[model samples]
Target: MDADLPPLTEALVQDVIYAWCSSAKHEITVPNCGAVWGPEADVVSVTRARLGHEFEIKVSRSDWLSELRQIRGDRRCAKWYRAHTLTNAKEEAKKTAGLAAKGSNCCGLVPPSYFWLVTAPGIVRDDELPAYAGLMEVVPYRHGIHQAHGYRVTETRPAPRLHRVKLLDNQLMAMARGVTLRYWQQRRKAA
Candidate 1:
């Protein structure tokens, strides 16, 4: 860590991700509970066209590895998770769907159309990311003089579209509800 840089926390990374998504013209940017994916996203953003983007924030390398393990399943053979190709991963998921139903940790469902992993600088390398996932890093500002006090989120690798379907009305509603609930919860906490 740079001496001038503050340590990255999950909340800080999440705030950076939310700001990044909002600046990208996401119509709806919310923290937590998209409810469209099998797992709750750290941050979820929706474009005006209703395309969904899910961001999973990790402050440490261990957390990142753990996430991959949970999604890819620990028992699967090397070819499955190591394949990296979306088609290959999907085929493996299909093969393991029964295993998932049998209480395995693997997630058989397709993720949001766009999936990203957000982390602090040096925590995840671009080459380490799975083919289907993108990488975003929160690093000290690299541009201009007399900079702001906070870090900026930069997309080191663009995530490929994993699913084609636009978010359905109910799914959008669920996200909206989550945002509303979070708002009140924060307000209450501040009180």
Candidate 2:
């Protein structure tokens, strides 16, 4: 986690994600997830789970891959997903194909059942959009709310697609500090 990130940015990311998850009809659980098995293996600042599904929250491409490398080799980390029934070998194979179709920039984080890329305006350039398309749904952050546009992943894709959304600077920083944005999004809907 980047210690330099602004405190307010971290708060916004956490608040938005929490709100989003809480509003979901399903019984969603945000776990203390991290990546520690791959080459870039490092602690994922914030991760979440719902119905045995897990997702990693990333604000940038570098952060996303760093966490992914950690889980690539460490069976203990990989086992966490299996023990929780979050994913499997068969599903992993399928996710790779799905990500290729979407042109995702992420380094394949066990094929997310759901992936969210929350960024600030002007942060994600136009050319970068196509690279991540279909890979994960984009979640845009604006004002103080985060909304789901539609389902980006499907049986054809299987893996959680990336969602790109613009978030405030404070929110972005909060995510860097390990805040859960799903919770914030859910809270907004409940209100």
Best by TM-score: 1
Poorest 10 consecutive residues by lDDT, candidate 2: 148-157
Cα lDDT tens digits for candidate 1, 1-191 = 57777788877777777667666788987776746554466788889877778887889889877766755675655324433434353454344444555776643443367878888777776667787888887778756432234778777888887756566555677788898898899899999
lDDT of 2 by residue, 1-191 (tens): 22443332433444444455555432433334333112221112223331123333355656645544543435566434432323343355355446645776652434333433443333334444322221322334333433422211111123343321122233224333333555676789999
Rate residue 15 of model 2 by lDDT: 47
Whole-model lDDT per candidate: 0.69, 0.37
RMSD of each: 6.8, 14.4
Q: How accurate is candidate 2 locally (lDDT)?
A: 0.37
For model 2 the local lDDT of residue 164 reads 19
Model 2 segments beyond 4 Å from truth? 1-8, 35-110, 130-191
C-alpha TM-score for every candidate:
0.73, 0.34
